[model samples]
Structures are given as C-alpha cells and as structure tokens.
Target: MRSALLHVSVPFVLCVTLANTSLFDEVKVDLAYDHYAERRVDYLPSFLAMPCNCLVNLAYIYMGLYWLLNCRGVKETEQGRYMREVFAFMAVLYAPVQWVRLASLRRAPAVLDQWFTLPIFAWVPVWISSIQRRPARWRAPGAAVVQLLSLLSYGLSLAHERGFEVALGCHVAAAVYKGACVQRDLGDGRTRVYLLLAVLSCAGFVVLKLLDHWLSRYWLFQRLTGHFWSKVCDVLQFHFSFCFLTTLTQRAQGKTASQEE
Candidate 1:
C-alpha cells in the first residue's frame, strides 16, 4: 500500500504541475527547431516553455523512491561501491562539459545551433562500471552482438542527416539480439514480462523515429528537435536495457543459490 501510494504520488504531483505549464509548446518549439540552431540556447526560455525540468525532477524523485523500495539490492556492497565510483566520475565530467557547452554558445555556426547534453552522464558511467566490475558469469553471445550493433547505429545516426534508415536497421537488429539475451537470462516467468516490456519499448522508438521523419519537412524551424528526441530515446533505451539485464542476472544468481541450498 505504501509503495503503491509512493508511486502514485510523485507522478501525480508532476502531472499537476505540468498541467499548468507551457511545456508542450516548448517541446513543440524545441522539436521544430532543434536541427537548425547555432549557439548555446538559454535554459530559461526552454525551461519556462517546457515541463522537461519538472519531468526530470519527477524522474529523480521516482528514482529515489525506487531506491528506497529496493534498498536491499542497492545496499549490497559491490553495487554500492560501483555506484559511488560512477557518481564521482560524473561529478568530475559534468562541470567541464557544461562549461564548454556554455562557452561555445557565444559562437554559433550555421550547423550548430544549440548544443545540449543529457544529464544521464551521471548514471550511465556508473552503470557501465558496475557491468565491468561485476561481470556476468553466463556471457550471452547475443549481448555482445547487440552492443556492436548499437554502436554501429550510433555511428549511422552521426552520418545520416535525414531519415534513420541505416540506424533504424541497426537499432532493430540490436533490439532483437538484446531481447534474445534477456529472454535467455531471465527464463519464462515474471522476469520475461520485464524483458518483453523493454523489447516493446525499443520497438516503439522506431515508430517515433518514423513519425519524426514524416513531420520533418512540414516544419520550418532552424533547430534539430527530432535529433534531440532521437538521442533522448537512445539514452532511455540503453537505461532500460541495462536495468533489464542487471535484474535478470541477479534473479539468475538467486535461483542458483536456492538450487545449491
């Protein structure tokens, strides 16, 4: 009951706050001009125009709640240590990156409108470090292939300006590969439900990309909002994948221990 209330409260507050804001307009504007801008855009207009900040704060709140709810898993010494190291690295990196981005805003090129960075740098490094330090005993060959495909998709995104035909292909391939690995690790049960959700989320992104592509020509904005959305989708997908894999591994380990006992 407490957990259910906690889950409901944060999003409810966020929704209420966002209901009064111009966030939707901002997102529309941001998406409209994301590709054509050249300079460091002010955060105020975007912040005032959109509810992204509110949403992000809400995400942090939920993360805190999740940590509280799953304190046992998070408190494990190995995971705790890795998280600390990752946070430290992010602290070191975010300042310099932000400073550079702010400084670069004074000189805007035609191709470079507003340069923005996702704050996920805070958690991503930690996730990678955790994966490295606590290696999975059962290495899924498909996971390696998925990672490679993801990398290739990223590269294709950098190369292709219009539609993500190549990137989409790579993304789908990687999603399928990763889904296979997740299914293999989790077996057929509750874990499979989580993995399936992740797979669907990944596939859903392709639909978003297609919509963005279809709408690209209608807008006259000078920014690359679609590009930013694509990048955001990529980051979110990666986070979901990591969480899915980690949880599956932990479940597998628990099953092994129970069998031995």
Candidate 2:
C-alpha cells in the first residue's frame, strides 16, 4: 500500500534525477568540474553529488539523535540505556567525522576520512555485544579498545603506504563479522528474512562499489554509466541495511517487553 508505493517511487524518482545529472562523470583531476572526484556518495551520489553526501551525513546525525531520544522514552531496561548511550556517542562522533570527511574531500586527501572512519567502525563490536544480550558494562569499553587499536593500526598502515588497503580490509572484515553475528543470532523466521535481505544488500553494496572503480573501462558499462548505476546501488543498499537493522532491533525490544509483562 503506502509502504509499497514508497519503496518503488523513491528509487524511480532517484534514478530519473541521477540520469539527468552530470555528477557521475568519470573522475577528472580538474577540481572545478569534478566535485565527486574520488569521493563516495552514500546514495545517489551521481545526481545529488556533494549535497547528497552532506544530506546523508545529516540524516545519520538526525537518526542517531532521534533514536537516542526514543530510547529514553522506553522503559529503562539495561539494553535500552546501553542503546541510548551508544546512539549518543555515535551521533557525537558522526557529526565531526562527516565534517572532516567533507573537508578532506575539498582538500583532496583522505587522511581525515580514514581517521574518523575508525571511530565509526568502533561501534560495531559494541553493537554486536548489545545484540547478543551481553552485559552492558562490557560494550563501551570493548568498542573504545577496538577503536583505539584500529586507529593505531591505521596510522601505521598509512606510514607504510598501505593505508587504504588496511582500511578497506578492516571495513570488509567488520561488515562480514557483523552480518555473521546477526545471522547466527536470528531466532525467528522474520529475523531470518531480514538477515537474508541484509545479506543481499551487503552483496550489492560490494559489487556496486567495485563496479564504480573498474566498470568504466568496459564499453557497454561506460555507455550505461557505471558510476551512476553504482551510486543507485549504493542508495538502495544503505536503505535496505538500515531497514533490516532497525526492524531487527525493534522486534527484539518488543519481545523483551512482552517477556517482562
């Protein structure tokens, strides 16, 4: 009904907008014409360009804060409090990290982006611990330790001229680990379905990202605008992952409340 319409219309509208724009043009060394040169826009980077990236960052900030507020309204379960704290910390980190990312792009160096990305990924272990119903006390410290170690490793990698490779490897590994944990802990049919969709989204995310890098060399892909398609996938992937994760969390919380009643 309304949800179905939204699901369909959003992508349709986005594709139309992207197809009409020049944002997906192959990266050029010339900064004036290449606003998105070597930059990854989360959704519709082709049409929305820098604005799209900025808007996405803003959305993350808003959602993180909104969810934190929502958590505050819920019955004060240990899990709820932990989730609120996690969300608050993430919101704080996300704002400055996004600003730094934007600044790095403007200056044509990804050092700041790499540095901030470490903190973002730090949320993974904590998130996983929460999902597993682990003690709340363990989550934040675990995440902080992981973040610090990741930052140190990233710095060393950069000094050795393998920064990007290390970051990419860590990112991929973290994603795989998160997905695995989610799948393993799925206890119901609905959760399993969500996990499957999330897995598909992850696959699409990786494939589209790769296409963005190498597909331009192919004649057919070039005509179809590889970069544009990749961005489309990026947008879809982000939404799908968000849907799966949030829904999964809501379901778990609902079950917890029911059991307590």
- Give the best candidate by TM-score: 2
lDDT of each: 0.39, 0.49
In model 2, how large is the Cα lDDT of residue 115? 45
Count backbone clashes in candidate 2: 0
- Using all chains and alpha carbons, the TM-scores for the candidates as numbered come to 0.43, 0.56
Cα lDDT tens digits for candidate 2, 180-252:
6775775467656755665575566457545654765666554344444544444444344444555555666
lDDT of 1 by residue, 115-231 (tens): 112222213332433343344442334433433343333333234453234444544554456456546645567656655665665555455444554545555322343333443
Candidate 2 has which clashing residue pairs, if any? Answer: none
